[model samples]
Target: MTKLGLEAKDLEPTRTIFHSIVSGFSCSPIGRIRLDLFGDSSHFRREPIWFEVVDLSSAYHALLDRPALAKFMAVPHYAYLKIKLPGPKGLITVTDDYRKSIESARDGAKLAESLVVAEERRQLDRIVALAQEASTAPIPAEDPADKTSFKPSKETKKVKLNPEDPSCSKYVVMGSRLDNK
Candidate 1:
């Protein structure tokens, strides 16, 4: 539209919705426009094309769908990366440039990488926020009354293993308290 010196207001209002496999949800078109598309000097088509205006950055200006292809009666050869359409002189063939296709693929990869980085950054921010909240919270105080010292519940007798050494004495539980196996 900018290349043609036309604005969005110039397009006829439409309620038509468009969807793509890349984007799962349906998009409402900004408007509909009838433009003359030329494959070559001999082959030209005037067709109504729907446009969905978005603020996202993209490598391609517009994506032609089945409706546009049907309007021009074009047959696309995926293996050859070319489209063949009927013309007054002969069959008009439109081929994609290899360099442009490579550049577009590179741009698409960069876009996907940037989106992943942005999501990771958001998750990091959330984790940082949670850490900050936890740090600012008050720590609970310990109760002094709950503290206790360890004590033995059973009575024991001291017996010297070596009679020559009094320091080698070992403590044994009372025989009456012991359970018989």
Candidate 2:
């Protein structure tokens, strides 16, 4: 495995390993342990969390030459010296950018659905308002010769219904249906 750079004490602080696979190679981020022997536990404990390199596809490696491949293959499993970078103090998390974009698209679709439902609700309310207006508005006066002409009246007619009759009791009067004496 030494040919593949796997050796004793091969493990070290802030080191990354590129595992050779049948298809290609895969590597992860390298991090070092904190050596705060004299300090408190806050600075002593450490976790092994590595962030994988981005866009390291098989097609990308296929484009590289022998010398370049050998150089990359020789990378030590651990960092030989002190390694420090700016930004995140702990392990850096890496994720697929394409996946993130897909999630954002799904969120946008859900928002669009909700907006469509709201617009439909507003349309229904408008139709209901129009119906109410049509019901209460005064009818236009017709020609005196029109036999079908009917006059609008504010007076409501009361119908005498037998309380003991099942048919009359079961039926409910609504609007002007019972108002035309």
Worst 10 residues of 2 by lDDT: 76-85
For residue 98, give model 2's deviation from the true position in Å.
Answer: 1.5
Q: Across residues 1-181, which tens digit of lDDT does each residue of candidate 1 receive?
A: 6876778887787777665423333456667666676465456554555555543344455566898888878897766768888766677887877677778778777766766687689999999999999999998775555345444555655445566876775654444455545
Q: Write the per-residue lDDT of candidate 2 for residues 1-181, one digit (tens) a residue.
A: 2333444344445455555422233445333222211112343223233222322322121122345325333221212311122222342222224454556557656655665687689999999999999989998876685466665545544444666775774543334545345
Q: Give the runs in model 2 whose Cα sits over 4 Å from its true position.
A: 1-96, 144-181
Each model's C-alpha lDDT?
0.66, 0.41
lDDT computed for candidate 1: 0.66
